[model samples]
Target chain A: MSDLKNNLPVLYSYFRSSCAWRVRLALTFKKVDYEQRYIDLIKNEHKSEEYLKIQPFGLVPAFIDNKSGQTLIESVSILEYLDETYSDFPLLPEDPLERAKVRALVQAIAMDIQPVTNLRILRYVGDDRKDEWARHFLAEGFTALEAMLQKTAKKFAYGDSLTMADIVLVPQIFNGVRFGLDLNAYPIASRLYQELNEIPEFKATHPTKQADCPEELR
Target chain B: MSDLKNNLPVLYSYFRSSCAWRVRLALTFKKVDYEQRYIDLIKNEHKSEEYLKIQPFGLVPAFIDNKSGQTLIESVSILEYLDETYSDFPLLPEDPLERAKVRALVQAIAMDIQPVTNLRILRYVGDDRKDEWARHFLAEGFTALEAMLQKTAKKFAYGDSLTMADIVLVPQIFNGVRFGLDLNAYPIASRLYQELNEIPEFKATHPTKQADCPEELR
Candidate 1:
């Protein structure tokens, strides 16, 4: 990794991490130039004392905006920060009501679905139960999410414009597929995921396409 | 339950639910006059088709803004809507960095800590292991949160005036205590929870103090 200058925002991320992927997509979507510093979760680099100083929670995707001297940890907050700071391509709609709808979809995945099956939780519960636990939670949450998507989806998760909802949705769908979930079970979500996967922002920041991705995955 | 007119934004909530409690506190804090319609999670009322139409996620704390004709699910989104629509006694800080910081703390608890130990997840993992799982995740997450609170707290999770961090912190601390975790282990969080508990807003919105609270708990 190259040493970051005071002018560039550095993102500490792991290629396979869903949380980190959300921020990467946001940065790319907003057309913000950032330095990507890999934190190898497989080797437990995120839990290091030095990294913990950057993110007290010992999680991936901590971002440092050197120009403004702002450091943000959570993916949701980091994405919001990028959207607010860049302002060229707004991730959230201008109307407060529309913004709330987009945010609801983001939290539905970020808060409700993904966290329960996070790597740390899986490790704590034991390796033997990981796949079963993940599949069950992902499917159960997606059942509701599918129903939600049916009501709210247009060209994207919200409407024609790509919003924060679509940004969060893509990585979570990636998680679902990685966990062996049959996307066909949730047809609405499946279709949206397939369509959104073709977008340039989603394509560029995909886990498999990342600079630090494993050779086999890349 | 009173009939909600086209004028009031009715909150679909269950008093015992930590997610619902956050919205309740936010509504009370904002001094928004709204109707409360109980959805008994214990009775599986949230899973009913009628209720599912309102919130496809089958989660409590769905808010319907009759005035705006918007129905929003997810506590964080609802809280943001309340902040934006009401614009009095703002839950989030105006400065983007401070708002991002406050949001990070909210996601720490809402996304990282709370989701792993939600009632649905607890039931899925088996009742025998519920307390063990809840305590383990809560303590681990709080260790990090304690460090965060140490760095950021004063009279509340952020500073003197209450912000989104305190709004999220209180209910999560409530969940921790409910699960039998000793708050004393994290002195900073314990102090804030203790102090915040003494305020009228927190007191009035306490789970046991709610209209839907069971008789014994009440």
Candidate 2:
């Protein structure tokens, strides 16, 4: 275990969680160096006594700022905290109206889409039904997201320059691809995903590229 | 249809949606009057051509401010917008750190719990497995929430004053009770839920109290 006295931010993450990926992208974009502790969700290590103290929810991507002695859960909250504390690359717009717009778009994906297709929720559907459930929900959410993107796309979800929305969209699209959902129906989203996937922050944090990602997924 | 030219704030809502209920509570708390337009989720009214123009996602509680012509979806965003624009009872704290704590608590309930138990996701789980899935997921979420509440509760989720966290919590706990989950395990949550339920803003906006809640649910 890394010494808490070092005062660096530590992220407890799994290799493949979209929620975890959001923070990884944000930290990389801001150029913050922090230690990483991997929690193997497949092995249920997240729920063990040691990990549970850090994250009561047994969710990955709990960020610990040893400097402030602050531990934050919820991916979006962590993203905002990092942006506010670091103040390097402004992840959210300065104007409150624009901030609300960015937040609404991010929440659209975070609250609406991610929870429905998360690994734990999929497991509840049983193995035989998991893929079907994943495909069905992803399609339902993507249809709406595609419509929003088609109407709102102006370089990114709101305008030029990456915001919290882009951070959320890329990983979700990655998951959509993993689930074999057709992207032809969502041209704007597909284009944005293609563009964002090539960005250094996103590419560096890609699940397959993560230092901890297993060889098979890589 | 309310005239877009008029400066009225319009709320597109399904009477029983907890999300819509949250906005209603805020509007009432802020003493902001809005014309309530019912979108019958049960009858697929939200998916109708007319409603689709207003809300591409066909989700309940889409808020449109005719004055500014600013439209917003997502309950938390709407709550924050109202808090920012009106500046009445502050839904969030002024201090950035305090605001982060409130937001994190709200997101814990909104992103982590509510989406997983929403009607659309439940329907996707199919009737055969909906109850089991709902029960299991809600129980898991509440177990963690209960622990969080135990640590944070001081008359409210954060302290003596009510915040957005309370607004999100009441509806979720109401749903938890409706699903027959025992609240006895969560005294902190139970105490606060009982306390918040007594407030006029929350009481007036109770799901059963809504004009459109079905007879069966009532």
Candidate 3:
């Protein structure tokens, strides 16, 4: 484990949740020390009475700032809250137009892609149909995302600096690869993910690196 | 139409889109006079070559700021841009914690609910399945939102002040009613929507008041 600062915030997360991964990446990028509290999602720990009080939706990656007594759910909202609260390494651009672009790009992933392919929803449809549903939805979203990324990308989704869009894209790409989706069709998205995976923060926050992940998954 | 101010921004919108109604509500609350350019979605004006150049997604409620030569898409982004650019009406709260709460509420509606029930996605799935999909998805979202709103609401979604959350909720509830979904299940959401519709700005921005809406629909 990395050396964490004293009295760091606590992050309640599950090993494989993409939404939790987004917050983990943001915390790593911001270099904020946070203690990880693993929620055994397979055991349905998230739906336990204790966990539901922290997050009514029973979603993973509920953040608790001990210093301020603030508990935040919803990954995007948590990211924005962190960015505003810590003003050190700004995740958002100062320019209004650029900020709007970054936000729109992030929303493209958050709103358009991720929710439709979430594991809980996939499981809701049962194993027999899960693969087909995942592929169809992810492919449809990725095609549009690939086109948009090609228009705006320089080094990352919105140019040189790694913004919130890059944070969101990496995990979705991971899920895409796991599902055996065709990466060739989304060359820009694939290339960007290849490049992003090399970064230390992303490497450290990979799902396999999480403490709760079994040795085989690792 | 209501005492126009020369050189104000131009809003590209559809008559009945909830996303478009969001911008309309914001413009009214901010008391900013602007021109409205209607895109006839029924006739496929939004997907027209001319419209695609402005918004690649062919989504309604793109805004063009004549003064700054900036164009913005996505209703939430546009609302944020407007709030930041025109600091008069204060659509978001000054406090970071409150701002986070408001954003979480807005996103619950915009990201979680509206996308699933959007017109374009509905058409993609075909008419036979659209109503079923819309009913199931809206209820899933409304249950969560109703719970959250019950905790945070004073008169609006986040207290007495009219914030962006209220702007998003009113239109979504309007859409819910159009689909004949039962509002009785979400009493808080229904009450808030009823309160919001009584406001002059919201009343003026109603779909029935739009120039292009058919007489039968009106």
Candidate 4:
């Protein structure tokens, strides 16, 4: 049912997967020409045994390079690899300390926030309590994020340059609105989100802009 | 109740904090002589306003570098900073692809595995069926980790070297045992866990060996 059998540098992605959206931003920013394979999470396409072969975690946005035939999973790792291999729009800062700061910001959302507030946990909480659970975790995470962003943000998440932290921030802010999170509470992050969305790469790779986002959502 | 004030490369750690343990392993491997400041999660020390200044997320394993006076939160970020700052016992591989692979593995555990089965989620699920909840999430995470390790692992989590992936695995595996999850289900991870634990660096930085571990538990 899918043409996943390919040799070209392929991205196994889903339209609404914020994790997948992060990859799309990196690939687009670096100006790398690559093929996109939409894995419909709504249809449970990502959980198939075949898909699991590509991403053992059975998550969207698994990447495979045509050059080395390397299958890279995990958004941060994939972003790092593309940045290293492309060398065009370097996602990481030059200084190790700055790079570490950017990475810490990246993981603060990726590890702490996203995982706690994701759909899997939501379903576990059940529909009656999902919104409460989502908002609680999102606000909790954003509280910390707001404080960190205050210290870290200059023009973007880490200085004037749009590092990996900014790429990660876009979708998280979008999700905050979706979960009915008050953007006013995280003033710095909301400002940075607006600034980041001005860039074509960020806008183009947005959840609603994706091909598989469905007609109504678009 | 604690000597929580210091600035000599201090680590906010706990006896059984796996997140903090990752930092300990990195510091030990790099042979960095740093001061340890235990934040007792059980005593709600990490949740205090003063501690929140050190770590906005109110979590343990926050590190402040002596030289740069940079306070780094999140275990992976701190681990990475230590790796980059100290040249000894490099935690990441030289090759970009290999490093990405290692990082992906690190996050596979750090983001996916650990966050899902941590104390936060366990408390959310409550004690009535916490074991079942933990085992389910842990097994799912480990299943993917096991499959990924089978391919990437030679002796350790990523080849023969003790990379960050291995550092992450040791604690997760310990958690697997604690949750009463049968290690036999994941052959590769268990064997690699054994091989990794044999190292002095791994043994020395273990959760049980830390100073704040309660006497009876030790």
Candidate 5:
């Protein structure tokens, strides 16, 4: 029950989707006033015919910038769009080299860590060994993430300022924790995760804070 | 032995690795003068101590820009860096929305299709069911990709011009074909794939053209 004529950006998201959470974080960090339309991923709402029309990929975090009439799908693409279209609190660094570094970290988590452990992938990995699978890959990806963070991190994953690296890192850490991963093994990543969690931008957009989060999970 | 003191950028790559192939395409398309240093993934050379220093993630396609003193990992990030750093034959569209569409298609292949079927993941998936898993996910991801291309495509995945979408599509189609996927199922994607293969930039940087490609495969 939404109108593109409203001129307010609407985000189709699920409370617990990590990909969805990354977009929510970018929007909140950019301080963009937006409306959220919950799409229950568990209910296969994303796979609906109507949803597929809006997002050909049938994924959460399809963003509609009503003013620009740009309906963007894919979290990485949506994030880059938000950063490009909005001026405030840039998600990426200004210099192309620095931006590449930050993006490298983003893909390390987004492509390497999160996608493999996603709900659909987990289901395919089989029920009995899913947790083991998630834990192993999460640990493996994080081992390299920690090494990269050790080389680049200061206050955040990149430098003192927050970039896409931190935006990608925080939610991925949440997933790692969900898989019961031991943070102690990755000291550098563990420290950044703890510090990033304390920031208001990250805290406000946390999965538990979403309207659609179940009472029991909250 | 490669030296950082050399003016030319050194690309650590594997001949058959799709992730590495993406960067090679970007570099070739941009017409940048560079040197290639193969990291044999099958031989576990990527996991070697020296290779770990170059790419802590132990992945191929780690690019070192000697002029900028930037060492970049991740093929997506590397391609963006090449496009941003070298201006000739831009890999992305000038318009922000157009760029997002192109990038969205890139991620649809890079993240959704490529990573799940990567060497490491396939090994973990077990030999018996690995092809089944890869074929299933590839088909699922391609279905969405075909739907997206149907709306936006003309000669390329986005428009008549070459963009990142075509770059991503060419390599993924290579992977899909290697896995015995039927290109006839997705007409739009199939057409783009056929068209992209005709381009010299894509043809020159193809996996089979790499120095490390096996004699029979080449």
Candidate 6:
């Protein structure tokens, strides 16, 4: 890894991490020129004392903005920061209530779905039951999310615009499919995933297309 | 339960739910005059079709704003909406990076800790080992949160003033103590919790002080 400079904005990310992928999408969509510093989760680089000093939480996808002189942890915070700092492409809506809708959808995945079914919890669920557990929580979360989308989704997760909801939704869908969930079970979410995956921003930023994805997987 | 009129803002909450409690705090701290419409998770009321229509996610702490005519789900969204719409005592900071820091601290509990140790996941962990599972994840999340708080907290979870970080943190600390994790382990968080609990707002809105808390628990 290159030494993180004070001038360039940095994203400490792992290629396949859903949390990190959200940051990548935000940067790409906003057309921000930021450097990437991969924290290999498979190698337990996030747990190292060196990484801990930077992000007390030892999580993947920590963002450092030279302009702000702040190293931000948590994907939601990074996403919000990027949207606020780079106003060229806004990820949230203008109306306060509309913005609230967008954020609710984002948290459907962030707060409700991701934490319960994350890699850490799966490890505790044990190797044998991991897939089963992931599939169950993903499906349950999707069931509710699907119902929500029915009322809100127009062309994207919230109307025709691509907001933070879509940013968070797609990668979570990626994880669901990886855990053997049939996307058709939640058709609205599945449709949005299809529509979002077709966007140009997704091509360069897909997990398989990242620098660190294994050759066989790519 | 009173009829949820369009004229009054109503919070769909169960007093004891940590997520709901956060919403209650935001509403109280903002000094917004809102009514509570209880959806008892203990009775599986949240899972019913009637409640699901209002909050498709079947989660506690859904909010409806009279002015916007919008029903908002997710505590974070509601908290943000209350802050934005009311604009009296702001829960978020003005500077973008500072706001990100407050939000990151909010998610340290909301996304990382709450989802893993919440009532829903504890049920999955089974009756025999619920406290054990809750304690383990609480300690791990608190350890990381404690480190971060040392850098940020002064009087509250963020510096001196009450922000969304404190709103999210105190309810979570309430849950942590309920599960038998000693608060002293995370001194910074504990100190803030101590200061926050003694405030008059908390006294009126604590879980034990709420309308629906049963007599024995109260």
Model 1, range B123-213, lDDT digits (tens) per residue? Answer: 8888888889988988889988887777788887987789888888888888778886788899898888888899999999899888988
Tens-place lDDT digits, model 3, residues B1-218: 22224767888887889999999989888888888989999999987988877776677888886657677777888888888777888988888888888988888888778876788667765687678877887887898788788778998899889899999998898888777568999999988878888989999999888887889988
Please write out the lDDT profile of model 6 over residues A12-41, one tens digit for every residue. 888888999998999999898788888888
User: In model 6, what is the error at residue A93, expressed in angstroms?
Assistant: 0.6
Preferred candidate (DockQ higher): 2 or 6: 6
Candidate 6 lands at a TM-score of 0.97
DockQ scores of the candidates: 0.86, 0.68, 0.52, 0.83, 0.87, 0.88
Residue-by-residue lDDT tens digits, candidate 5, A1-218: 25753567899999888888898899999898788999998889988999999887677889988757668898999899889888899988889888998999999998888888888799888889899998999888988988889888998899889998888888888877888688999988988888889999889999999999999998
Question: What C-alpha lDDT, on a 0 to 100 scale, does residue A170 get in candidate 5?
Answer: 85
Clashing pairs in 4: none
Per-residue lDDT of B77 in model 6: 85
Per-model TM-score of chain B: 0.95, 0.93, 0.95, 0.94, 0.95, 0.95
True contacts kept of each: 0.91, 0.64, 0.38, 0.87, 0.91, 0.91
Q: Write one digit per residue (lDDT tens) for candidate 5, span B110-169.
A: 888888888888899899988898889888888989988987899889998988888888
Alpha-carbon runs more than 4 Å astray in model 6: A1-6, B1-3
Measured against the true structure, the TM-scores of the candidates, in listed sequence, are 0.96, 0.95, 0.91, 0.95, 0.97, 0.97
- Candidate 6 docking: what grade? high
Worst 10 residues of 6 chain A by lDDT: A1-10
Stretches off by above 4 angstroms in model 1 are A1-3, B1-3
DockQ of 3: 0.52
Kindly report which residue pairs in candidate 5 clash with one another. Answer: none
Interface RMSD of each: 0.9, 1.4, 1.5, 0.9, 0.9, 0.8
Please rank every candidate by DockQ, starting with the best. Answer: 6, 5, 1, 4, 2, 3
Alpha-carbon lDDT, every model: 0.86, 0.83, 0.82, 0.85, 0.87, 0.88
In DockQ, how does model 2 score against the reference complex? 0.68
